[model samples]
Target chain A: MRRNRVLAAVAAGLLLTGALTACSATGEGGPVTVKLLQFQEARADVVKDLIPEFEKAMAKKGRPVKVDLVTDILTDDQFRTKITQQFYSGTAPDVVDMGGSNVTGMAGAGYLLKLDTYLRTWDGWDEYYPSVKKGARQRDGSYYSVPHEASVQSLFYRKDVLQRLGIDTAQPRTWNELIARLKKVRAKTGEAPLVIPAGTAWGGGSWTEGLLPIVAGTGSTLYDEKSGKWKLRSKGLSATFDLYADLVEADLLPVRDLHNPNPWEPTKYEKFPQGTLPVAAQGSWGWKYDWGPEGAAPIKNSREKIGTWDYPALVPGTEPAPISGGGFGYSVNADAAHPDAAVELAKWLSSGKALARQLTAVGAVSPRAGLADTAPYSNEPSLLQAEGKLKSSIQPPLGDGEDRVSQAVQSATAKILAGEADGSQAADAFAEEAEQLLGSTRVAE
Target chain B: MTTVKNPAARPTRRRRERAALPLLLGPSVLLIAVFVIAPAAYGVYLGLTNTQLTGFAARDPQFVGLENFRNLLGSADFLESLGRTGEFVLWSAIIGQTVLGMLAALLLRQKWLRGKGLFGALMLLPMVVPEVVASLTWASVLSSESDGTFNRLLGLFGSGAAAPLQEYPMASVILINVWRGIAFAMIMFQAALEDVPDELIEASRMDGASALQVFRHITLPLIRGPVFLYLLLTTITTVGVFGLVYFLTQGGPGQDTEITSIYIFQSAFKYSQIGLGSAASVILLILLTILGMTYARLAKVEV
Candidate 1:
């Protein structure tokens, strides 16, 4: 009986130990495990290849951390939902890959670890473009995330199609000139010459991908940083809407295609390659991820066939600047057990060959200054060209009330696309809605 | 007389039994309280607050009692979605699925019908297909491309790319949902019809009653229990349908097909207005409850 009791006790103790071990993320005497969560399929393979290298580098830096990365792919939508829930539930991943838009809100909600102290000591901090570093800074002058790759918005046009139509391939000096060019294309071919993603279906794209570059080129900011107010109605905003109205009224834009569930499919993938759409405002990703040999719809000799142009100014006197935003960036969760290691890993992912490989795979320009002279970045001419556009690029201040502003843009542009409202009317309605959401004090005309 | 010596013992035993009642029912009551009641209560609380999925409001939400609901009621989009949801449920669930399923079931019950097993299998195919797969199949069929299944069929008659989804989003969604939901109703009605006595129909037929009269007077009344049950189930399920409409048209083409559920999803996940979405959900819950109660009362079914 004594022997049997002892055996039962031993079994029970062993079972309890196993349960506790299973529950713990890092076991006793085991290396601290840092979890990395991400959702970019274009960079998934590259990221996976870089993880072992990251682990080795960290070991050399005196942190013997075991990186726990889940290879299960998630769509962007899934990532947003999962990350939000995880943060609220206090089970957030140690390090995360997210869009630039999410940084401000996440930082404000206290979900992200403030990275200013770490960044100050890091050598690569000076290598990142000034615009990128400034965009990542919160209103409180704290950094919460580091931009991994930069997606500069540019005018993606078909070179062969433009040449055939006898249209100048040079960048138009102003919005009016660009509009005239679009009209010429439509008059010659009778096909919608441009696609600027609009409608509520396009979601945030209506703001960032479609409107921001034009707004920036107009020399008026949507959300003024100095006044800390959303420019609900301004000359620049009206000009942006007027341009949209012109495209819609003249039938120079694919209005129907913009309302499709996935507008990018019909506009960028199918129509552009088929020559039905000649010009579109797209991120630098259009070079490879949207039109490359390995893209969903590859155009033969895409690099040779496609050309890039900066968004033009509203008036001739001012120089035009393209828009740039963080394509994908890394952040350390505030609740991480291995925050130091996580921060190191994030820094490792942002600079050197790792960032180059990731950016090249996704057709994005590196925010880091010298990466353009390196092997992988130099091999790709698209990246080299896009690098030059980065310095002249403007990243609109996005943090507080960004979601509401995006919605307002989508709602206004959607009305423009449907022909329900003209530019002035839509601007009025947009102003009203933004004022209601952000309050009168926070909105400006 | 025989139990007179221990009469107090019987009362004690009865008291013990009464005390043990809670112990026996504790697990079930606790489960329901945790799973159903707690979440619902939290939803109600969340509805009264200005809780957002992101930004400062996410961490420290302020109470804005009835504001979310007031905004929802005032918004044209929400009101339109309610109307569209009503039309969708009426056409797809109440009328389309019920009638077609009954017809299919009646035909399969016919002795003269050949290949009854094959026909039933074919009808069951949509039900067996995964929701996402079925949605993809329908998407392909109704694609705007000239080579799409429906477009190709239209092309045979010299029609251009109809783009039926963009032109007729509600009708297309209703049609697809009707197709997907028919099998469940058919199965239910088939089982109910099996319990329906053939002798009564034969008697009625001999008494100069036509097939239609017999069905109207006998079969329908006999299967009234299952009919109401199916209606209650189908109505609730149809109102909650998300994947079919979402994957196909995501409440698009300018909110033409934005049903109540889709609106709630957009308000919550898309717009990140958790409070507004929760308020909408609370209203939806109350409406569904009233609907279920009305159905139960009309059917005179036991609770």
Candidate 2:
């Protein structure tokens, strides 16, 4: 009897251990736990709040799944490192926050699930803007992610400061005219006239925000789509560097603040709000998320106080437009256990109602086709203005080596800021670095 | 009678003991092999490949032996970072922290010194403060604005409005490191100083040796073993430091303080070139090994 009792005890213990392991491994006998990852706090909060609603809706649909919201407030670089490691280990969250430039690279690596099949059945697919679809789809014509929002780069200036200094509040039609206006501001007031992110301190922003649009305005492409090579030695790149050099030489740029560890904090939050930084190259989100009533540094009556300008043409007679860039969105991990359930959650997160909430919460423009015509978006004038600009917005060619290109551009701009190199020399350094990073075949002179 | 019958049993037990020795050490050997040797070997292999965090290489990294090393060796930025790292380790770790720590340790040993416990605790405060906190504190103090603590102090002397961090990025980082590291050196040297024989110091003093001479010839020579050990420890720790300087300058103000560690991080994560970073790490490992061997050789002297 005692021997039988010992045998029975061992059997029970083994069974318990096996059950626990299975439960932990696959959430067996419990809700199918789908993990959702997000980087930004505001967006994460919105998603976190929507988790319960998703759980209830899924239960009603007879496919119940619990979402575990994992929030990582990290810089772009850190986030990339984490997500890459997670996917490489096959332990990635079911849903991930995929940024614009990350879509092509991550999808190509087989980390993201091909969402073409899922989107074909998703009813909300028809509601996304054409640009949103284009942005979300990789070059192979497969959609790996769904669009969450869209943003456009522009010149944001303090209207009161410019008007007070007798500088024209009207948009400058060309780069030279823009320079003249900035110089006039400097002459009229000792305040730093403009801030264009430069150097390693500003990271990728030196290229994306400060230089890319102007390079486009000059009718040059960083990446030759047809040739499939990066244009590191282009005249447009040199001209942009020259413009940076000019700004440094003329003392019109806030070089000191630009080198701050968190350059944006001072330039966008403090100095600009205080009217000491008169103009800056920023994004549409800057209206509410940077300087408006709910921003990091709120400027009173910011909608009326701040004005926007299309980045001017780098050359004469070239039409200039704001550069449209992709905003953060959700993608399912290829290795996810319940791809169907994760897809359902992702679709719900980007539904019209969810998209509207995300836009208002994060101060982003809606990527939904007709959602901007109603309620929250329609009530905000700045959002309407940004939406209008979206019709003619130009998006630069982006792909695998964009990050490396951004780093190279940052290095070049750093040299310009430090007075160590002229425009031609900086451009040469940029070409050399780009060639070294991407190999000789990928870089074009 | 029983003892006499166990003659073969003794040899049997001896044989069994020999057989069990391997079993005893098997777990430890396996642990070391798995944890230390395996990772280091993998790191070396990774150093020889074109592994990246994303893009084509990330999925199917191809072996590109010595290419990363060659690229880094030829790169001006990498070379500059190496030079900066050398300067940082020398001034901040070897000299500044060591000298100040020695002084503090000597001061604490004085019989006339009051509140020795309080003084020692205060000196150790920086070591207890988390690295992030220390970095943030220094950043606030050395902020560019006039209201910053350090700038405010400068203002009282009528020489204000100075952005010390921007103007002296390397110096600022080194000083903050020294502040963080002094307590460690102090503790090591203090323990060594306590072990010094009183008879030796008394004998030297009776010979009419000056205070400085006694310290230089007696205390210094007596503490050489701990000094070497301390140097090795500090050197290794200081070389790997990331958060302290990263939070403060991030190797910025135009790469003024881009030490090797910062460069490695940028190359690996920011630039997504894991192989290049691994090559740099391999080089750093080799250099550290050489330094450790040299220190070990020197430390083998008789106390």
Candidate 3:
């Protein structure tokens, strides 16, 4: 009896394993399913809108390919963490949606399928702006990700609030001038003047949106492409830290609320719309997706009330050192079973109508120069304005461990803003931590 | 003599019993080997490699012996995380849960207490609520908003809304964990308290012993085993805590609350340094093992 039971149990286990294996294998039936994993919250709706179009395109092409999109609504840091976990377990989706620095890092490390060969014959690849395409290409000039949306970031302010308070709303040419303006706005309104994403929960936004402009304004930045080194302790980096410290010391930045899980929500979506916060660094999408009529606040008078300005230089005389990045880039997994189908799906995702839908939904500045003439692109004034600035904006080169660098910078910036560490001390600590996090050989200076 | 003669002949009763036992347990043994042992073994192997989430190394990982372990030992973040984790366990499990749970159990044991069933249910309520809900509920209560429950309570005393989570992150995490975990200790202590003979307490009272004296001398000694058991369980569970703290703080206001679990998670998944993460996990495994062994020795039982 016991022997019989053991035999039955063994058979059951075998059957279960076999069933699971069969289910996991690339199916041999009707339509090939391409899994898309994405963390862009705004595109969740856009993807839903595009599924029918994708099906129709496939049917027209007679490929019978099915798109299965898996959207993770977690914040960027959280979703990327989960994506890495999936990569380790060999269960990652066929296509992934990532941003400039992160997608570049993933591509550099060979997680993404090289798309140069695939794109050489594709017609629309050349229409992308050179800087935009730079993000999708590796060190060896192999194209991995297909760059779609170009992100244009700058300071967003309430024009009506500034005018009401008798303050000048002109774009400041330098960091000192911006501070002077903020001091005036604060003294006049007696409210929090600027909101820099500060806490660790804000992730790289703390460094990228708030600190990088200051660094660039000083004529140096984090990633030095020539040596492939992270310049952790530079004059520019220290200056950036000082700028953040100044904000905290002046009580200009909302440090407390920035520690919340959705730090941007209160500062950008709620306070910015209500005119409580005068200025915040925002992408073009910040208006439409986060604070416009389609956003959480839905402030009706947003178009008239809001204004955008270029992030200023560190000194008064130099031009505004603007920074733009790949807002969303799509890539295929190297390990995906249906790589060809995944490639087809990626192409479809970046094509005219589907890409237009995404660009409209996200209100992102389009990288494809031709999209500027598209109907949907023409409709968004904010996007059009941002696209005009993309030519002059700086697209910083990314390194291998950009995520860790971002986290390390974010942690140090957070400590400074929270008053846990002084500026010089925080910079020193950040340099050390980042060097360790990125591994020493990755850092040159 | 029959057992010795049964080598090639019919099996003896003891032999049959042993053979039947192995056959009966074979399936479960196989399941455990496949599920638990295989992953554990794989984890150890991963710890020895230079495998990352991306790169050529990810495709073909090369073993680096003890490099990851050395790196972990030398890492300030990992060491700091270890220290913070120790503090969290000490406060949340050893002191907070055990002491508070014991007090609740003592209160509930009073014969004249009203609505014992309702009180019992209330005590068990936090244990039943989902972890995400519990953490979020605490977040709302402790927020910096002036209308938040904690701040509102302090308003009558002329105090402003001070976000305890932002100001006293570690304390807030410890308090919430205690709130969530006291149920286990309470229920266990209640059972232990019930097992304490009432006749001895009554006799002690008749001898002019006060309630406190009886609890300290007789009541406490009887429940010593349960106390150790509770500490042991809470220690292990508290050390492995992830989800609640992850949601509440994500290991920051600035790494102030970065416990070992969070650190390991960040190293492996967030940094995509899977080998380093796996090494840290192995260290964590050993640390927990040592803790478990120490607890077993203290409890004088196989734990």
Candidate 4:
């Protein structure tokens, strides 16, 4: 019995060891582990396909590279925890997908590799939009990352609902016409005329993007470049907050209950398709993923019923302003074992050719200008409409203090909507918070 | 004549046994020092510096003395998180363990209980389930949407789709923690209750003592040690409630459910404030140590 027990123990130990070994093994290789971590939910399936391609390409060059993909569907808060833990332990992934705001802080910490040398040599670098290129580079002009994809926020409206309400299907160019039409639609259909996701970090951040054009169009600087101070108390900002507050008060948005947490991503698309929510202010990325093939399949022949338009200006005096949205570039880990290989992969990932391939594989818009005019995307009118909005898009201001400013804006808006604060109070509170967080700081550049 | 000879000259035997004790305990002591004591000491050291995880070479971390601790003490967010953690531990550990454990002990002592063995096994189910799995399951059941199982069940009783986490953040987390932790308390209490002398209870009954009186005077005193130990264990476990908060709410509906552990996680990982995160952790450790020492005193008294 004792001998049998000993044999059983040995067998169990061996089996456990073998199982652990098998789990960590990424095929037969010289054992190069590239940890790829991302926060976005929509990118998972595309990454699942892309990793094997990357591995195969590396293998062809006699490099036994294994991509250890660690996909996390994290909220803004959770993503912070994950990035910090990895950075502190010096065990961060070889490739990290981070928000644009997070990049500066990480770069400051010397966690990200400088990629100016690679960027200078890389072909197709000029194809990217100038703003996107600027956004990817560190303030010191040391390029740290490259733009992966670009997204632009647009007004998504149900053409059928607009027609039913006797509102024009043609896009509204100014806030006055848009609000009038929204009120008319609300009166006619008894459904929410607009759906804004207010509570979610991404959702709230989207509002900042949407409002930037209005702020910029007003010829008011939202952030003082020299002082690195946020101008939330500016008239333009106050007007924007007031406009949003008015929309909520006018019964045009979902009730406070519906705006509970992170705005329900799929629900907004579903409601818009179902004609329950007549309009949604969201990113162009939502059109494909949230409304297209992978998204909730709206009714058959519902293509004509959906239309994209630039977010109308805050007033008739201003031009249509839309915040341009785009994916941030991949940063090579400064401490990566194979920095050259990592840089090479990053370069390929950001190149026009690689981006085009990715755009095709996953229905994402390339950050490269004119890429959307080709093939599959060009055939889709909604995508074409989104691409059109991207032409006049203004990039949101980037600073080390943007996250705190963004949160203050969201909190103030929430309070205003909750009837606890007025528009001016909200604006004042936001400015106060921003000043405390950013007033003493200088812009990195 | 005055000098007493050692019995059989057993110095070698004593030496052999003395050497064996050190050999047996050496590895365990080494492991504790390395894994536990070293990290804790390092945490204190790290907390005093303004370190960022990323570029250690570019920006040298400055020793900030007690500035990090002072900042944390003044931070409303940190204070709010500490309060939430305290509430969670108090209700989930103290109230949860006491009631469920006592009920379980009483049930186990019943004579006519059907499938007693099966029921006992079932009671231990939650303790055996992985913490992540339990958290995920509870998250699913209490999800914000109408598709959640709890919502579906509530619909039958005419309660509309209400997100438990959003509506009652602390209560919802406490309920889940209690459900997951009751098994440990129940099993411990059951074992303790079993060791109670039947003869003592019989004597109390012969003196015309009521069931309640016998339980209060006899059974309760016998199981006091286990009860105190269970409380200490539960308190320590509840102080670090991370998985449930992370999996379910992510400390949200606007930081309503933010606990100390979640805040520390966010500071360290999200904000990349390694020093600040470590400071928060040390503060948490201090709070836990005080609670532990208090419990230790209580446990000694019971013994």
Candidate 5:
């Protein structure tokens, strides 16, 4: 009888929870309901605010949407598993959140609905930057996702510390100059000069922030546009690895602490602000989301202590190029019941009020123009710098083999850094790994 | 109790028994067939194809018999993962847990420790704690940084914060698993000891046999069943452990702790190479089956 009572209570609780979550849809007069599943659970608040705003907008249009929006948050692996299961089971939500390359892969696999028609028809379509818009277009010239926010990675340093040591705060013009600055910083600070995200956990980052900037500076990109293959064995790629090799030989990058899942915790939060480390590759989000007041380890006087340099150029006598094109955006599931309504909802959610709300909540740089007057972003002046850098980006492809390419680059770089192989050999290994994973696809020279 | 023998009724009774068989065992048999047997068969099929989570293969998989297996054979990552898994099982299950737990159970049987139920309960704290929590706790303990508890303790001894996981990644993970698993092993051993014939031990002592001699000749032979049972359970469990080791190390510092299970999981999920993962799992399954059968044969236990 007690066991039965306990089970009854559990059943009652589940029913209550379901009822509360279903009022807009399953209630007596629920409207055309649309479901949105967000993987980055942290920013669910933005969408929570958007749902009501969307309803209000639709109500004003005399076609009120009593859309039951479910914001399910999950870790990366859980999201991958759950979303894939949903996809295979035909239970995926009408709308879902995905990253840049994730959007490409999802769209390419026919899992996501294309947004080209909606984007072209949307009034606010012209507001987004051309580069930002271009980044969303898959190889078939279709918009798979609506670009929401973007980030630019560069070498973050301590201006005060560099000034104290009488080193130039001016941006590095070449790889050698950057290395010289790091060596000088090491001699003066008596701490490790740099921290590269090289561990297995920092899979994509190991290549994106660590190696790609150098590759980009030397006029190399991951995707071979003309041939539509990854350029893993290029001279610039090997040179990028060699630069890391140089850092490894000098014991510049902190090999020990780099093994941590969040190398940024030590490098950005503790070491950089504490003046123990003077230089590291950092994304724009690191300013506010990482070490600012909103961060896990908020540094006092973060602005005064930290500074950004154009990530050092590969060749001497050239300005460093910023690597861009990574952010969260919404994609409508291809198998959505309300595909048109979902696309319309997605269009509304990706711009104006909703997107701004999200950008503010995540403290991300707005990929589109005309959002400079927002509260949190307006309050932080450094975001303006980040905003300016977004246009000057070297965009990578967002599709199949993109993730594998990242892993291959990361593994190769790790081997080179650990002295298991030289840059050229690591280059060869990278080629082999990439080709093996992406069969019949040759690495572009 | 039979009053009359009816040959005609006997065939009818046999028919009734046969009819009842299907009704009695149908649900469980059906469930096992669908969930277990079908999935295993499907996994073997997946191994023979180029199925993946992404790309063209995800949409249109092509069958290539033994290709994935052939690739896995030459792959250093696969071999290394299997080798590391073997090392982890040998250390954590075969040696560490069995020896420590047996010794602990033996020591706790003393009359001087009578009525110390709380002490015995305290020993089980690690086992009862959730796997993620235990792994996280040890992550803090094994951390080389200043915030690490183990390093903090070592600071009093005038030693700096040192990276245990960095220097000994696999051993650290194995030791953490062993520590958590030892409680269960202890409980099993303790229960097994109750079935040990006390009279035989008393007679051995009376005969002036040394304690070691008594344990070797009498105690071991008596509890051989439980010992084999413990080995089988631990080995099977340790071979499949993914969460604790994953939480603690995430199969890295460059594949140092990427056990076979973790490798297969990463391939299928993280890397999106489902066909390769399926192939790898098939190999792992065969290896485990062989090991299990070997142990069962040794124990003379029908499995």
Candidate 6:
């Protein structure tokens, strides 16, 4: 009886230990794994450098989160497929980066967590601009994303080339002055004076960003909020189209020869940095990535020679026009295991201090309002110029009709450039398409 | 001996054997049903609906019923891609595999060739190279820049710049596919040739027939079945060519070399139009099915 009792006790102890181990393995307070997906390949290295810092910070807070960064070098569509598959399998990443248009569709699918409750109490929420906050919120006025960075479209000119043509580098405040300078530069250089990439989809969108500010400066809304429709046929838009056509017809802009499959390659950053192209219309981020310390060293001492200026108004007396605010942000997955941890990480990443550090490293504008003016980047002359210009920058209309309007503008510009359609025809076609896309109620005057 | 089993007992034994047979084959049958048939059926179902990946939870997918098919029919891009895929199948599988394979088989049959076994193995080097490696190698060889092997060779011949793919996108990819595929075709044909009866060829030669005449009359007829088999196999393989096109041009320089498989991939993954992409895939499948049936009937007669 004594020997049997001892044996029974040993068996019970083993069983208890096995049960305890199993229970402990699946319990809370254990390291929770999170996956992060991003688009930019260059940002992979930056994330790698920052993950240890994040982990260390979390350790101090007694939160044990193990983030598994899965850097996918895929196109926008490919990333969507992966995200969709994960959702189907019930194994989606805790956080993801999505384009502005994609967020609505994803949120509608219930794949994103509503962050309204968190946003209301978050201490650092006030750092973001009102426009940024408004843009990041869903239709129900619930916030879902944290804005990381913002970009503005600007004219990147080769100072040496402009100086060679006896054009002033001190900012041209009006469209007529800019055009006069472009003609002089063309006459002296015998090269395409203004570079625009029409073949690339993103490149095609550049026209809308470049022209929106000019139209807005002329006191015309690109899209009327009351009507919820785009105004391609408006007098302001027609003038913008005419100016674009005139530029192309006069050989001021190379639209015909520049219609190569990869138009952005020969004229933009690739050639601009190598001194093959004189001027390019590009985003502020492109300026940083293509010209900053992390980028290819500018043509020996060309850093001082390179200059940036805002899009000038159509007329002299119009509001100083600029296209503002285009960039990516982070949002937590609705099905994430650790929602709190994900939100914490997102908020930390979007904080003014963190954004400032990122800007110092990458030379991009922070989404936070005052960071551009007060951060370490404020001292840089070109950035300071961009900051000064940001006040006049006009935000692109946000709604279902935005993409259609933008595409119409691009297609119309392409037609005018190709000489298949004149400015008037292009403008008329654009108006019809925009009206059809935006519905009659939203049509701008 | 005189006593015989009852009919009911015999039938019961037969029934037991039938049940056991299923038990024996159950695992394999279940695997095929789960992995192959189920997914294929699911794909067909998905092809009929207008399902967007992002809006899956809130939005009920409308049964668009043939809208995807109609869209594909109207799309110039889709038609162009199908034509490109057909051209690829012709050049790569028909001309490259069949003709080159026959030539290799004939060469290997020569008694003058030393180390026949070793030579036979050497011929399969291209087949053994990984697809990714092969694609990268071909890409480097056909690179548009001066650094590429083909351009460098052209330079040696007194040319400045030569872009084979850019100039002839379809032909360039076909050439790469053919070069990579010839080894398998050669091996299959060589095996088929070895199986041809030596006596028949000897008899034809003895009747004062020339070497070419004997080969034409006897060897060709004898090898027809295998040749037909090879053609069918190669066609199926070539029709689904994606990796080469993807690593090479990505269906561009203005969609000059886009194929059906590449189109399906773009629609499904890149464009996020899963339903439309699935429909495109079904179209490709129907095309391949027709070809397969035709080949099967032709192969039966040839054999």
Highest DockQ scorer: 2
Candidate 4 vs candidate 6: which has greater lDDT? Answer: 4
Scored by TM-score, the top model is 2
The list of candidate 2 runs beyond 4 A from truth reads A1-31, B1-28, B145-147, B155-161, B301-303
Give the chain B TM-score for each candidate.
0.93, 0.93, 0.92, 0.91, 0.94, 0.90
lDDT of 6: 0.69
Quote the B-chain TM-score, candidate 4: 0.91
Write candidate 4's Cα lDDT for A1-445 as tens digits.
Answer: 9999999999999999998788667334464777777676656556666778777888888985677777888775567556766765698888886656567667866788888887788776877777677666655557677667767766778888778768887767777788888898888877667865554333335344445544555556676645544566666788877776788778887643443555554347456777878788766666566666666443445477777777677744667766676555688788987777777666666554455555544445667776665555456565555556666677766555555465556556655655656667767766764443332343221
- Candidate 1 residue pairs in clash (backbone atoms < 3 Å): none
lDDT of 1 by residue, B140-184 (tens): 999988889999999999988888888898999999999998999
Task: Give a tens-digit lDDT track for model 2, residues B1-303.
Answer: 354576789899999999999999999999999999998888889899988876644678889999999999999999999899999999999999999999999999888999999999999999999999999999999999889998899889999588878888999999999999999999999999999898888898899998899999999988999999999989999999889989899998988899999999999877778888999999998999898889878987432
Candidate 5 residue A360 Cα shift, in angstroms, is 4.1
Off by over 4 Å in 1: A1-31, A315-319, A432-445, B1-25, B152-162, B194-200, B203-209, B217-225
In candidate 6, stretches whose alpha carbon ends up further than 4 angstroms from where it belongs are: A1-35, A38-42, A47-84, A97-105, A138-141, A165-269, A296-302, A309-321, A373-375, A398-445, B1-20, B55-59, B114-122, B202-217, B301-303
- Interface root-mean-square deviation, each candidate: 1.9, 1.8, 2.4, 4.4, 2.3, 5.4
**Two-chain DockQ for model 5:** 0.36
Listing candidates in order, what is each one's chain A TM-score? 0.91, 0.92, 0.90, 0.83, 0.86, 0.82
- What lDDT tens digits, residue by residue, belong to model 4 across residues B56-145? 222678787987897789766689899989888888889976788688768988887888888878877888998889888988898767
What is the alpha-carbon lDDT for the whole of candidate 5?
0.77
How would you encode candidate 3's per-residue C-alpha lDDT over A23-49 as one tens digit per residue? 767454467888888776778788878
In candidate 3, clashing pairs total 0
Q: lDDT at A1 for candidate 4? A: 100
In model 4, the clashing pairs are: A80-B269, A80-B270, A81-B270, A84-B269, A109-B55, A150-A326, A151-A325, A151-A326
Docking class of 1: acceptable
**In candidate 1, what are the lDDT values of residues A1-445, reduced to their tens digit?**
9999999999999999988878674554456788988676667777888999988887776677788886547655456656777787898889998888777667767899999899999999998889888778775678889888887898889999999889998988877788888899999998899998788888777877877767777777677777767787788888888888888998999888888888889999998998779898899988778887777789999888899888888754677677784577899999998898899889988988888888877888888798876767778888778878888787766757777787777878888887888989888868876665554666765
The lDDT per prediction is 0.84, 0.84, 0.81, 0.70, 0.77, 0.69
